[model samples]
Target chain A: MEKPQFDLQQAISRSIQDLYEQGTITNSDRHELQAHLEDSAEGLITTGLSEEEAFLIAQKRLGRPELLNEEYAKVNHNLRTDKTWALLLAGFAAISTFIALISYSGSIYYYLLERFGLSNYTWPVVAFLCLQSTLFLFIALKKREVSNFLRDQVEMNPLRSIVFSFTLLALVKGMQIAVLRYLPKSFSYPASTIYGFQGDKLIEFATYVSLFCLFVSLLSIFFSLRSPTKGTWRAAFEKPSIAFLMLFGIGTACFAASTRSLSGLLPVPMHFTLFGLVYLMGAALISYYNENSKLHLFFFGIFGFCAELGVGVVADIDRAQRGIGQIYTPFFILSLIVGLMAGWYMGNMLRGKDAIPSR
Target chain B: MKEISKELMASSLAPIILLILRRQESYGYEIIQEIERLSGKKLAVAEGTLYPILKKMEAKEWIAATWKTGSTGKERRYYALTQKGHIELDSQYEQWNFLHDLINTLWKSPNLTYNRL
Candidate 1:
């Protein structure tokens, strides 16, 4: 077979894409460079050169990805990569704000659970989760709103971004508390173990509900940094069916087999702790796509921190407060950094096996 | 005519770009062509490296750019000088004039020129 002739247009596109992937150029930068390349080639062609020759010369003159990247990097001092720490700080602030909100609203939720003649505090939360999941699924099917919402988030001023985000968080928790708190103050307490969990399980139910909601928010922030796509769910490293199955299976298995469980570590469950490992791997699996971009696994930190907050909520309900060790809080962050570095390495390796070229 | 040193060519690009944009709005390729035309091809710019300079100047607010459709129906990033750019160009012109006057006087004095060389 004769050697294949490469399409120079495609070659230039690939080179520009490489520049983007290398963080030498952004989407707009790629557009600008692509326009430059085409214009340069056209000018060359008008000078009596053949199209292929023009393209070859133009492409050569445009320089290598590494060189272009260095030049662009020198110019683009405000690149998002420089803001990684700042974004991580914002995530941490949100997590702290969430923890405080849950604590502040605890008494109100407890009172309403008793006042409504309701023995089931958790059923409402389960209902909320079901509703949220339904909306997510609908959005996934429709493939529009989640990405549009995230695009709006990226355009938000980074300073005011955190304030607006936490306000939304406060509004959500506040409204729920208000509805439950202000419900007609007349009914007697019920004596039933049906529907969701009974009153005795209230604390556990609340902890999980709070943790789930916090994770959803952290995930939103994390995914907000991604290139806008159709739905928030698609940014998921693994589909929930796969991730939940894998995580739930491993969690259940470990929780079942553990000789000493649940108490010695204060409030941290062996099962959810297992989820940390599973999620880190899941995080690693997707890290390749975000590798050259900003936030470099800091969102994994956010996700991990969300899990760590579960410990706080549970420990607050327990006889042993502050749980585990003196530096338990720091440990959560350490897990984030260490876990992400490990996962990022693993993800890069996984990326190497991908048929599509790494971005 | 002797070619300007590439190092000199590179250092002087920012002012030249500012000057060209001050004339009217132009995109990267057109700016390069304009620079080449004015220099009579004596100043050979590394075309690939010009963009980063443009980008840097844009970042500094010396120039502003917008994507516009040209008469040829092609979209190009047309860059125009900003108020800051005008101020910068004036400042650069004054500095260049001072340097040019200093060099002229030095050249007129044979002993000083030879000693400096």
Candidate 2:
């Protein structure tokens, strides 16, 4: 009696169905299996067994399909739940640092305003130094935890995160200064006097700080983009660097144009535009950094948006009371919407469903 | 015929598992038995190692599993190949075969001796 010939196609089809029924094979896996069976069919057919037998034999040689399915499922679940928590913690820590900065600002400003008087030439200088020091200290203290948390959340590259964050900060501050310069005289308040420094001295000091930040940010970006280590820094610079650079350049040009048009004095629109650009970029960067974790994006978006909005509202409220009109409302709404959308989109794009390696 | 390292064993295990389920849905013991029989008892995977790999593959969306009542009325998790698993197996097999053939060729090269008196 002759043995029944093996039907490779039927065997593969049956196996695929069984796996699918078992919840082992997903849609993507099904497609992959079909392709594999097609490729291996010829080799199986060359064996003495019929096409089906050969395919079955080849598959048997491949191993137990259930084991692979189970392992993959376990890894994905851990990443989604456990890894997600780690990312959230990291994001919270980052947000806390920003809060600490705001706290420090309030403390310094009030302390200087009450003690040395807001008009004292030395108050702004002292306040600025104090604020910078406070921020630096807070970051240094929380650096390790934040870094580890960030590392856990966004697996691609570490240096990229650092570069992205720093670059975003500089771009934001630079735009802010340019906008302030271009705003109308009515909007112009002596920022230096508000802080308590001589206007010329405050401007010189701010220029130095901004220049330093820009240089450091650029260097970090270069290393991150070109790094062979493939750390977070590298990942951070991968896609967003182009967008960031483009926006930064355009922002600077707008600032310069506004300044030049207004005879080197900054206008209110320019200031608003700069703040909008910075806030949007910062939110976007945070979203990108925490791409694997949605909670981070949500928290950062809310906090950053509210902060910018509060500032805009306060700046416009005085004018509103006097019936000078609500100029800041439209810009404020537009900025908030754009910032939120960008952050949300970036977060989603980064948080792909692909299985990452189990740590 | 050399013993496979843990990493190599782990990587190759996915294809081996898929091939077994192609015939019929099988529980852990039966699949293990089949692999032992096919490999001529050269491969004996511990339960701890085997279970983790199965879970990982499932997570990757490569294969699927379900519990079935055994003859003794106890539930046993049976796994089978999904379409994706089949494709992965084929690709992995091709690569494995290519590498195996290349290694074999290198191993079987004639001794480099010429015109010795």
Write down the RMSD of all candidates, one decimal each: 12.1, 22.6
Give the per-residue lDDT of model 1 (tens digit) for A124-187: 6556646665554444343333443433343335556666666766775666456545543332
Note the residue pairs that clash in candidate 1. Answer: none
A195-307 in candidate 2: lDDT tens per residue? Answer: 43223343334433443344434333333222212323324433454455445334433332222222123565664554455445555554555544344434444543454
Q: Tell me the whole-model lDDT of each prediction, alpha carbons only.
A: 0.60, 0.52
Q: Against the true structure, whose DockQ is highest?
A: 1
Q: What is the lDDT of residue A175 in candidate 2?
A: 53
Task: List residue ranges in candidate 1 displaced over 4 A.
Answer: A1-31, A41-60, A65-75, A78-156, A175-359, B1-6, B37-43, B55-64, B73-75, B82-117
> Of the candidates shown, which would achieve the greatest lDDT relative to the real structure?
1
How displaced is residue B8 in candidate 2, in Å?
13
What does the TM-score come to for chain B in model 2? 0.82
Docking quality tier of model 2: incorrect
**Backbone clashes under 3 angstroms, per model:** 0, 77
Flag regions of model 2 displaced more than 4 Å. Answer: A1-76, A89-97, A103-107, A110-114, A117-146, A149-242, A250-359, B2-117
* TM (chain A) per model: 0.37, 0.29
Calculate DockQ per candidate and list them.
0.53, 0.07
